[model samples]
Target: MFITKVFILIIIASITNINNTSALKLECTYREPDLHWEAFSRDYTCEGTIRLDGDDENIRTVTNTHREQMRNADVRGLMIVQQRDLQKFPKGLERHFHHLIGIDFEDCGLTKISSDDLMPFKELLQINLSGNRLTELPNDLFQFNPKLKKIDLSGNLIMHVGLEIFNNLQHLTMINMHDNACTSDNAYATKKEELKELVWELSVECPPTLDMLSSSLFGSKEFIDNIKRISGEDSDDVRNELLNEIQGLEKIVQELKRRL
Candidate 1:
């Protein structure tokens, strides 16, 4: 189903002819397998231009109007094509989209996501954010969504990742982050200390599940270069627990490599 959405967006981009600065709009519609366009009228557009930041009053009005129109409706799914460059995740999405099961931000140029605004998407199952420009995620970005199953962050500029972003996500099974800077030595160097802190955190907290240990995220050479940062601690118990965590992580990475 996500692949079908990607194909639709590719077709829309091929047909859409706009100057870079011209404002583009988005609206909600359900598409069948035949790919029907249900509504393209102005009312469904919510009088909003897809943008990250602009006039505060205009932004509020746009989001509020959307909230009013779709209030209390069982909006199971939604897909928005910015059809233009939006430099960040559209604000106020959390206030309006409550029952969303899946969302996509393909090719929309989002640099970062809002940690606070995502609190409403507890039931959200899938999130496809491929082809954005995201650099990092907030530490508690996934705090509200424990049941989330799949996340696709492939084809982004992501470099830094918070330690707690993957914590306690027991249901997450698939995460796609291929072709990002997180695996590169230079980019990992920028956050080497931070990554070490995450590795050290395993002594007290429940280590993230084996599936969440994808190397595309934590596999940079610089990360392994400084992997022994916590070895100097005096407590052998702490060192033993850390060593166990490290072995589990290495095993996960090896499994991932075998699959490739």
Candidate 2:
């Protein structure tokens, strides 16, 4: 009887462990890649779009499987939506979707994006990052994506627009900037002649000099907080050092302007 009881207990423990492992596994469907219309341009083509929609864990699993299946596909666009658990932009996507022309991360919980996140999308034409938790955009966010034509940044928490952000983006004709925290304005170029006016309007809404300085020097408020946490008592010294660096950069900029 003692031996039988011990066997039963072991079996129960094994079953419990199996159940826990199954519970921890993310559940998602791996559907075959379909020829769908691209979200931004509404173009119908087999290689136009790949939609990945789920919570972060499920999407991650699906993305991995899809990447394998679409390894040889000439994928031109990607859309990831309803991902509340996705706080940062998924890196290394350009590895598989190098030919991607448009990317949509709508309704995701993305809080921030860096220049490096977009550095690889050189052939990108349009981007829709609406309905995210983004509070600010990096200064060089679009530096590498010079071929970009359209941008949709509506429905975010962004409060400022930097003048330098749009520099050299001559091909950019439309910008959907409505419903952000800063102002309810949309910039559209009806004709080539009107594009300059729209661009100027976009630049004029930039945050003040002090705010721009903070953003340019530190990248984001969260980064400053992280530095404070890591440096602790030396945070003040670190901040002063950064300010001095900013001053030096300003002097260089002024000299360059004078020379030009």
Best by lDDT: 2
lDDT of 2 by residue, 1-260 (tens): 99999999999999976554432122322233353323334532122222334332211222333444344245566766666766777655655555778777778889988788888888888888889988876567898999888888888888656656877687876777677776545544545666677557655664524455455655655557756655776667667876676577678556645653
Best prediction by TM-score:
2
Local lDDT at 245 for model 2:
61
Candidate 2, backbone clash total: 0
User: Against the hidden reference, what TM-scores do the models get?
Assistant: 0.49, 0.58
Off by over 4 Å in 1: 1-26, 33-54, 57-72, 82-84, 184-260
Worst-scoring 10-residue span by lDDT in model 1: 34-43
Clashing pairs in 1: none
Task: Return the TM-score for candidate 1, rounded to 2 decimals.
Answer: 0.49
